[model samples]
Target: MDMTGQRTLQVTQQQAWEALNDPDILKACIPGCQRFEPSGDQKFAVAAGIKMGPVSAMFNGSVQLTDIVAPQSYKLNFDAQGGVAGFGKGESSVEIKPLEKGCELHYTVHSSVGGKIAQLGQRLIDGVAKNMAEDFFKRFEAELEKRYPPAEEPIPQQSAPAQTSAGVPVWMWAAGAAVALAVVVMVTR
Candidate 1:
């Protein structure tokens, strides 16, 4: 699978790059992260609990950063194993561009999986991966906002709108139901 995405953050490129390298910040941002530790200057070992369909597993992974280009871009090689569930290996590139208000983070990844995960079907796997990525960045961006704040403007509270009352979007509720059904079917199959 190939995936690409970009997000603009309200912080300088330098600050964004620095935060990206911080193990503590990454641990806090990564969803289901059990442990994340730096093994070397640009290498890390991580363990995360992931649930996809019925194939939930604890994944242990290593990531290596190469082709050094400080604060601009770098290549990431990653591999992870999840016992009976499956394994994943991939390569990606992350680029940072300084914007007037903050920074733009662009990433592209080419990845593959095997075992039960691969058997789950491309649409399911892709959707799950995309959701995971979105979740990670949401947390990461929140953390960065807390650490940096805005230079000139104060951050706004994310209170739910009165229309939703509970703040849950109707579409999201439907999506959740759909995913639950899909998971049930996938696991049973």
Candidate 2:
């Protein structure tokens, strides 16, 4: 399947990049993720429990970061297996752009499933994937707020109280893209 989207965040590109690569932040933000232990440089051993409809499974996976261009973009390769439930392998890319107030994250994923998961109708699988994507972003956004709350601007005591400009922060998490599909498909079949 092929998917693409972007989100804005109230952080500098460097801040976004750092958080995206932080193991602790990723483990906390990923839905159903049991562990996100770093196995080596730019590599992680991941375990996540996923539920799709009535199916549920614990997926064990590994992810590698490649083609990195610090604070700009990078490519991620991921694969996972869930016993009889199925398996998935894919490559994805995330590009970060700096904005005046924050930054934007753009991602594109190309992945394939095998075994029972491939047997599931594409429509159903796609629907589930999309929903999972949205859920991942929502959780990532909340985590960002909790971990890196935006600084509050002081109100001017002059003619008018200064108003803080609220940037449209879609929230940035490169890790969000890396594991979202790995976990979502763990239970598909």
Candidate 3:
């Protein structure tokens, strides 16, 4: 899947970039993140619990940050495995553009999955990925707001749609797929 989105923050571009690189900030912002530890320079070991469809899996992962351009942008290379559930690997670039009030942060992600996770189907996985992204950003924004409350109340950020295709949310799609799978199994038996 490929993702492209932008968010405006009430903090300076430099502050936003710094927050992105902070392990404590990231751990606080990441949903279901159980452990996030620095491995070495620009590397981290992460363990997270993820629930998609009917399967809840624990994923152990590593992330590497490279192609740094200071406060402007950086590339994130990440890979994770959930044992029997399969694996996911991806790269994303985050760019920060200075704005009048603060900064405009843009990110693009390209990712792929294989094994049992792939058997769950694209639309289902896409929905999950999109929802997870939205959740992560929301948490990040909230954390930033807590740290840097504006003089005046900042306007609530726009939320991306839960489901970008077929007009159904991720959870609904997961439920539908689960029902369909159950039916197929019953009929085969």
Candidate 4:
């Protein structure tokens, strides 16, 4: 499977890069993730519970970051196993571009799967992948707000939603890919 997406973030490029690399933030942002710990330089051990359609399983995996360019971009390689459910392996590239207000996160993923999960079909797998991505972003945004609240400004008569401030790093992008891959594995089962 292949997937691509982008998000507008309410934080500077530097800040987003930093947050993305933080293990705590990544762990929190990845839905159903139970563990996200460093195992080596730019490598992490991961365990996540995922559900798709009528299937669910616990996936154990590893995510590695490569071709890293600080506060800008990186590539992620991920692999996960779920016993009888099946397995997923993939690579993703993530880039952060500065914008007038904050920054944008762009990512692309290519992955393959096998085992019982593959029988579930492509449409189901794609839907689950997209949902997992959305869930990750929501959690990531909330974490950013908590860690770095927006600067206080006087409220205007017409109140607008206050923007939160934060950042992400290359590692975070890797984590996102890991989460997406894990979810895909679950769907296949």
Q: 1-189, model 2: which lDDT tens digit per residue?
A: 888888887678988888788878787767788998889888999888876665678889998999999989889999999899899788889988999988998999888887776777788778877877777777676777777887976644576433334532222233456368335521110
| For model 2, the run of ten residues with the poorest summed lDDT | 166-175
Regions more than 4 Å wrong, model 1: 153-189
Q: Cα deviation in Å at residue 85, candidate 1?
A: 0.6
Model 4 lDDT tens row, 31-106: 8999999999999999989887777889899999999999899999999998898998999998999999789988
lDDT of residue 165 for candidate 1: 60
lDDT of each: 0.81, 0.77, 0.80, 0.82
Query: How many Å off is the CA of 1 in candidate 2?
Result: 0.9
The sequence of per-residue lDDT tens digits that candidate 3 reaches over residues 1-189 is 787888777789988888888788787767778878899888999888888897679989999989999999988889999999989898888889999978998888888888788888899898888888777877787778788775754544558646747788766886789688544420000
Q: Which ten residues in a row have the lowest lDDT in candidate 4?
A: 180-189
The local lDDT score (0 to 100) that residue 182 gets in candidate 2 is 37
Q: For model 1, give the 10-residue run with minimal summed lDDT.
A: 180-189
Better of 3 and 4 by TM-score: 4
lDDT of 1 by residue, 1-189 (tens): 999888887789999888888889888878788888988877899898888887899989988989869898888898889999999889988899999868888989899999888998999898988888887887887889799975564535657632356778755776699688544420000
lDDT of 2: 0.77
TM-score for every candidate vs. truth? 0.79, 0.81, 0.78, 0.80
Error of 1 at 101 (Å): 1.4
